[model samples]
Target chain A: MSQFFFFLTAIIAVAGAIGVVTLRNPFYSVLSLVCHLFALAGLFLLLQAEFVAFAQVVVYAGAVMVLYVFVVGYVGGDDETVHPWDGPAQKGIAFVFAGMLFLELCLAILGSGLKALDTRGAGFVPGFGSPGDIGELLLTKFLFAFEAASVLLLVAAVGAVVLARRRGGIHDEEQRLSFTEFMRPIGTGTTAEGVGTRDAGINLPAPAAPAAPRSDRETLPTGGERP
Target chain B: MNWFVVVSAMIFCIGGAGVITRRSPLVTLLCLELMLNAGNLALIAFSRMWGNEEGQIFAIIVMVVAACEVTVGLGVIVAMYRRRLPIDVDDMRELHG
Candidate 1:
């Protein structure tokens, strides 16, 4: 049963990782990451690292993925705007290099053998990876590191908020405004003829007012017009 | 189990491949998280085998650190996106003088 569970999660994780790499839509890629992290949590359970598994799901899958989803949404779906031929050769080189690196690591692992590292003491006790044991260690032997981690997290949170909330100086504001205008949907009640034009930086005159839809008059009764 | 090492290696490789070939910064970030999780799996496996609390503790610490990295990294990416900058790794050469 345990082996079955492990295989299940391991396959899910590997497939999700592949999806994260190959999916063209950034939204789908983020979803795949969420799937990958959830499976990782299951793997943690299989290893009996209960606390770490839960933390993996809560932090990486939950919080981190939410942030990623937001960023992907904000950036739009098609952000990889490089032309097809621009860097195909470099991408190919990268794939070959990565494959070679993987082969090296695999060979090293095989050469070293698959046995666990020898230790001075016996192997871990049952429930050693449980939350209670972890909490005890956090408050005792590892208290200093725990507190330091908390401080680091606090600083990170503050830094992210500060960096994101920064209202840049006037020039930045102007640039940002133009970018927003550029990103606005073309047909959102804007009458400007040049708004949807392909030309860069050429603002043509606004088109005439759109004719009122005859369907509106036809759908409403003679005296049932909206006030 | 030996299978743990094998699976971890496979995951590490998949993540490495993703990081190597993916163009978008967001995809690269996702691949990085995959790599980090692969490391966590190996750490936990060793921790389980050793019967020690240290490995699990380190894994938790890694989780905290990964969280911090994602927060700051995504913020920077979003900031760059707002500036109309392409979020491609090759295009992000502003750091190069």
Candidate 2:
């Protein structure tokens, strides 16, 4: 059963990855990426790394892929046209490099003689490496790095906001607002009847007469009106 | 079947080729991600064969880092797209010296 799962997960992962690369549409690329991530998480689970697997799903499949989708949506455009092949010279160079790397990797794998790592020992059991174990190790042995990662995430969040707020940016507001100011309630001025009445009063005078005629004129006036 | 390994390897090679040959930045990014995932498959296979936990750990780490990379990379791509409407790698010559 485990072997079946291993094969299943591997197939899913590889297929999804292929889809991600080969699909021309960015939306499909992101969708395949999510599929790949989830499959990888399943593979991790089969290997008894439950915590890591869940984190893979949460962080990669959940959060990061969403970020990719958001950026793709914001930069809405068709995929750029891709030339099928490179120039002969570039292709030759790439082929040579790829061949060399392939040879090197094959040689290394053959010569290393290291057997596949056996996990039939400590930390190999299902649910053995629980979230609590991870949390403990994160806070104890890897405390500094853990905190640093948090700081890094905070920095990334702020940086993303800043990057998303450049002049002529899609989300740039007319006024440059600080982070706190941006996050504050957008319309806190008034929510009561007074504000509603005030807004109506402000808009009333302009639409008091034949607003329909005005709009029609603005859109497409008759020949008489045009003259 | 060992054919699974062969299939995975072939997919990886194709993905690598796409990454190297594609001029579209988004396609390249997608191809790069595909290659990374191919690595994940091999790692998982090796872990299962050797019965070791290390390969799984490495695969998990790779996935995490890949996620981070894709996020930042897409963010950069979006920024570039805003500056230049198209997402072609050829037109992105702002850094060329």
Span of ten consecutive residues with least summed lDDT in model 2 chain A: A202-211
For model 2, residues A93-146, the per-residue Cα lDDT tens digits are: 665765666566555555665533223323354434467655666677666666
- Return the DockQ of model 2: 0.28
* DockQ of every candidate structure: 0.52, 0.28
Candidate 2: residue pairs that collide: A116-B50, A117-B50, A117-B51, A117-B52, A118-B50, A118-B51, A118-B52, A119-B51, A119-B52
Candidate 1's C-alpha runs over 4 A off are A84-88, A117-124, A166-227
Task: List iRMS (one decimal) for every candidate.
Answer: 3.0, 4.4
lDDT of model 1 at position A30: 93
The best candidate in terms of DockQ? 1
Candidate 1 TM-score, true structure as reference: 0.77
lDDT string for model 2 (B30-87, tens) is 7777777667767755655654545655665566556556656776777776666567
Cα RMSD (angstroms) for every candidate in the order listed: 11.7, 12.7
